[model samples]
Target: MHRARLARWVAGSVLLAAIGWLVSIAEAQEGAAAKAPAAGAKGEAAGRRARAGQLPPYYREVVSEEQRQKIYAIQAEYNSQIAELEAKVAQLRKERDAKIEAVLTPEQKKQIEDLRAAAKTKRQPRRQAKGNAPAAAPAPSKPAPATPKP
Candidate 1:
């Protein structure tokens, strides 16, 4: 059981990592598109070179203008293909999640949901405390017992 649970966690982590990578790529492409200039050959060429500047430090430094254009062209060529594959991956992931959810008994499903809610409640206070939460009121002090003959 522990092994199975661990395997699930590992798989989930890998999936999350892949999703994050794809999202970053998509954002990069979107940013490049937004920054690309309107019309002229000079503007387009500049845009391509600018996009190439987004490359890692080593590659960005070594690549020539010609290479930048080529790299930019290659990225443009694959962008749509990558987007299609990402969409397919998302559909497959949704189906996989539905199938996994279906395997759970209703009671198990409810139990997991309750566990999630409990976990969320546990996190909420910590988050609030981390933020600008108001200081909690001090508990009222008890009055000293009536003084005996001292």
Candidate 2:
């Protein structure tokens, strides 16, 4: 008789656990289903904005398709120029450092190297965060024109 009672208790415990798990799964599924429509709407709105060239405020003056293309070209040109300038500056710094190293004590050279390393590390985190942050929100669209009288 005691053995039969123990077996029944074990069976009841297993059944309860299974039911709890299923209920939790069902709740999660329902929550996800409730959220999906809002998420889908947001995605569709973003798509429409993109198609309309409704970019962020910073780009307000350049949001038209033609203007955007021109801006891209200009940006590419500026990027190339900036890269070339940066390379030249780096080369100049290397030459200057070499000249200074010839005159500086070993301790002074080490200090300069430490400073350069510190600067590089400090800049890296800021650049990485900038890359990870969400894109800026787009500016509001212009009001629609009034319809003509019939």
lDDT agreement of model 2 with the native = 0.61
Among all windows of 10 consecutive residues in model 1, the one with the lowest summed lDDT is 132-141
lDDT, candidate 1, 25-124, per-residue tens:
8877886877754579557665655664355558888999788667776676556556766786788679778878998999999999999977765566
> Candidate 2, residue 49: CA error in Å?
20
* TM-score winner: 1
lDDT of 2 by residue, 1-150 (tens): 788757856865676566556755775677567655577776754454455433346896647777765655445434434555557557755775576488788998899899997776556655666786444433345577799667
Give the Cα lDDT of each candidate.
Answer: 0.71, 0.61
After the best TM-score superposition of candidate 2, give how far the Cα of residue 60 lies from its true spot, in angstroms. 4.3
- Relative to the unseen true structure, what is the Cα RMSD of model 2? 30.6
